[model samples]
Target chain A: MKLTRRMFIQGAAAVTALMAAPRALLAWPEKAFKAGSSDEVMQALFGSADVTESGSVVLNAPDIAENGRVVPISVSSSLDGVENISVIVVENPSPLAASFDLGPGASAAVSTRIKMGKTSNVIAVVKADGKLYSAQKEVKVTIGGCGG
Target chain B: MASDIRIKAKLTGDTAEVKTLMKHDMETGTRKDKKTGETVPAHYITEVKCELNGKLVMTANWGPAVSKNPYFAFTVKGAKAGDVLKVSWVDNKGGGSSAETTLG
Candidate 1:
C-alpha cells in the first residue's frame, strides 16, 4: 500500500465519522440537566409540564433520609408501554436527577441512588403510551448533601 | 487503567435482572471545598446504555444529583442465560467506560 493525498483525506473522513457516531446515537440533554426547576426540566426534556398523578406509577423511597448524600430510590410502573422514567428531587439545586428511556423488551422499572440538597418531594415521572404519569413522595433529610 | 464498572446479570423466570455499579465522583459543581473554599467542578456520568446480545435494551441520562459511585438496576424481558449484557457510560468530561457480563 502507498500513502497518497486522497487516502489521507479518506482516512480523516472515516475518523471524523467514527467520532461523530456516538454523539448522534446518544444525545445528552444538557439543557434539561442544567434546568433549575422541575417544571423547566420537564419542559426541556419532554416539551411539557402536564403530568397526571397516578397510582400505577410507584415510587419507592425512604421516609426519612438520615444522609442526603446517597438516598436510594426505585421507580416501577404497572402501566403498559412504559417508554420513559425520570426521578426528580424537588429541592435540589437542579431538580432533574435521572432519566431512563426504556426500549422494547425492557421492563418499566429502575432503581438508583441520588443526592438531595434538602428535605423535599421526590417525584417519579413515567411516560407510557405518549402520556406522562407521575407519583411523588416526601423524604426528610437530616443533613443536606449540597455543601456545608 | 482498571475498569470503572462492576456488573451482574441474573436470569429470573423470563427476565434478566441487570445491575451495574459505576465508579465516579459525581460532583454536583455546587459543593465548595472545605479547605479551599472553592467550588468543585461537576463531573458525573451523563449517559448510560445497556445492551443485550448487541441490541440496546435501556438508556439512562443522569444529572449531577446522582450519588457518587452510582448504582443502577433494571430488567430485560426475553433475556436468557448465556446472553451477553453490556453496560457502558459516558461522563460530562468526555470520560467513558464499559463492562460486560453474561446472564446466568
Candidate 2:
C-alpha cells in the first residue's frame, strides 16, 4: 500500500480520537474527590440532603491513632436493604475516603484502612431502603496520615 | 501478569469474613511528583466487586481519596468453606485485576 499524507493524517486523527474517548467514560468523581470539606464532598456525592443519625449503623475506629496514615475503620449497619456505605475522614485534604455499594444478599459491613491528615471525625454513611443514615467517631491522630 | 490482590475468607457459621489488600499507588492527582514537580494524575480503584460461586455478593465504589495499597474487608452471609470467592477491582484508568480464593 502506498503511503499518502492524507491517509496518514486521517489515521493519526482517528488514533487521537480513540485515545480521548475513554477518558470521558472514566467514572472518577472529580469534584467529590477533590472537595475540601466533608459537607461539600457529601453534597457532591449524594446531593444536598440530610442524613439521619442511626443507632443501627456502627462506625468503629481507634480513639487515639498513633499513625495517621493507616487508621483502621469499619462500618456495619443492621438496617434492612442496605445499599451503600461510605467512609469519610473529616480533616483530610480530600475528605471523601472510600465508598461501597452492596448488592442484595450482601452483608451490611465494610472494613478498610484510610489515611487521616490529622485528628478528624471519621464518618460512615449508609444508605438503606433509599434512606441515608450515618454514624461518626472522633479519632485523635498524633501524626498526619497523608504526609509526615 | 499476576494480580496484586491478596484475599482471604473464613467461614464461621453462616457468615464468611473476607479480607483483601490491593497493591496500588492510588495517586490523588493533587500531589506533585517529587522529581518533575508536576501534578500526578489521579489514579485509583473506582470499583470493587466480590462474587461468591459466580454470584454477585458485594460491590464497592472508591475514589482517589483512598490510601495507597488499599485494604478492604467485609462479611458475606450464607457463605461456606470451600466456596469460591472472587474479588476484582477496576481503577480509574480502566485497568483491572482480580484474585480468587476458597473460603477456609
Clashing pairs in 2: A68-A145, A69-A145
DockQ numbers for every candidate?
Answer: 0.74, 0.54
Question: lDDT, candidate 1, residue B65?
Answer: 89
Q: In candidate 1, which residue pairs get closer than 3 Å at backbone N, Cα or C atoms, i.e. clash?
A: none
Tens digits of lDDT, candidate 1, A56-101 = 9999999999999999999999999999999999888889999999
Residue range A53-78, candidate 2, lDDT tens digits = 99999999999999877788999998
lDDT scores in order:
0.92, 0.84
Docking class of 2: medium
Among all windows of 10 consecutive residues in model 1 chain A, the one with the lowest summed lDDT is A23-32
Measured by DockQ, the strongest candidate is 1
The digit string of per-residue lDDT tens for model 1 on B1-104 reads 23789987779987988788999999988889989999999898999999999999999999988999999999999988888999989998999998888888
